[model samples]
Target: MTTLQGKTALVTGASAGIGLATARMLSHAGARVICCARALERLQIQLDEMPGPGLAVELDVADAVSAASLPDRLPQDWQAVDILVNNAGSDIGGRQPFHEGDINQWAGTIQTNVTGLMQVTAAMLPGMLAREQGHIVNIGSTQGLTPVAGCGAYTAS
Candidate 1:
């Protein structure tokens, strides 16, 4: 647990819940934080509700082009991130039978959870490896951990 003084960190899904908590904690610990999520409205609301200096990036991690643009989006001076929290994911439309489900719903979930994670991690990795220092925390679903009926499709993919 470092103080994070003068460090730059990016936390995905930071507009709510665990992501929000971690971002705030990191800020308190002295990290220069960049909080990213899909919902601009929610992110703005969170930003307005909170107190202090953190960058809020309107990002859709599931979008590969956007994830690939990370280097371009980073502040020139603060391009080197010391911490990356890959916490963006969504369990949309609840637990429904695989047959009855839209199937398209699962795409977004997997794209965010699996593909998006890889893209973001890959994008940020060079910087970390170059400096030989960094930490990445990924959030995974409990359903993906076990045999849940609806989760079958999501877990399998």
Candidate 2:
């Protein structure tokens, strides 16, 4: 059990699934947790249920403007993140082959999973490097390694 007392953790896509679970675990371990998601109401509910200190921020990582402004939007106390969990991702478009899929959906998937992740990492990296202490955890899917039929965009992302 790694103790994270006095540390702060930021988790994206924290409105549900693995992101929510990670936020709970980090909070239980004594880290102040900041949950980021597009749905502020749901995020707040999750934060309220978690142990220790927690905050909820509405963020859409897929949106370049939103991603770029995230660092500036953080409250002073939560700005210096000790742990970053890049878990904001989704499979867009219905199950379909690459050629049959919606191009917009494919672009969205890429923007969120790749470009958005990079933006968030870049936004937070400077603070981490300056402090000389931090950890970044990128959540990846087995689908990325083992391509599955009808999930071309998701697999590619």
Candidate 3:
């Protein structure tokens, strides 16, 4: 392993599940990590359980105002971000046929999964480009690739 010992990485949706798994892998490679998620307590607990030191920030990607302000809110200790994993995503809340689905849930689904994903990525990518080195990983569901009748809504994610 070419040590990532001095590198800094950020893993979004790090409170649980796949984001947590990715963070663990990156940390094992010797990268310093900063975790973000809407659930602060869960993020805190996950960070505590991990084998290294990291910062946890509460973030809701659906909130444009908050997402826009992330660059300025980075910790003083964090300078350049070397690795970025855009793993924050959400499921749509309807299982009904596309016609019968709840309208608000449908809209919320796109807003969070698609629009919010873009917003967060836009805010971070510029910095990575400025540094000329970084990595981005987006988590996409299998349902998005192949249709599962009831999960079309979540697949819209």
Candidate 4:
């Protein structure tokens, strides 16, 4: 197994599910993990449970300003992230035909999954490039490829 001793990892949407699991794994691997999510309370709970050092930051990736400001907002010790997990996403507005779907729902999905991902990556990439070593992991669903009828908005994102 690859050991991440002394490395710092940032995981978005890390209050639950896969993001939370990944944070734990990274912590176990000896990386200091920074967990970001809108649910600050939950994130703090998870961070407290981590076997290694962890920090919890409240964030809403769907907001352009928030996503873009992530790097600058991190504590100095956690700013040079060696690993980034772009795992924040949403599936609102339930299943419905594309034409019948709510425009707002579609917009929300796009904002979170597409635009937010881009903003976060742009904010973090410069630092990684300058350092010449870093890893970015983008979590995506199989729905992106299958494109089920009622989930067009999600698939498109």
Candidate topping TM-score? 2
Question: Residue 146 CA error for candidate 1 (Å)?
Answer: 4.2
Worst 10 residues of 1 by lDDT: 44-53
The local distance difference test score of each candidate is 0.81, 0.91, 0.80, 0.91
Runs in model 1 deviating more than 4 A are 48-52, 153-157
Mind giving the per-residue lDDT tens digits that candidate 4 earns over 31-73?
A: 9999999999999889889999999988888988888888889
lDDT of 1 by residue, 24-117 (tens): 8888788888889987678766766444567888888899998989867977876888899988877665688878887688787778878888
lDDT of 2: 0.91
**TM-score of each model, paired residue for residue:** 0.87, 0.96, 0.91, 0.95
Question: Would you list the rank order by TM-score, best first?
Answer: 2, 4, 3, 1
Clashes, model 4: 0
RMSD of each: 2.1, 0.9, 1.6, 1.1
Candidate achieving higher lDDT, 1 or 3: 1
Task: Choose 1 or 4, whichever is better by TM-score.
Answer: 4
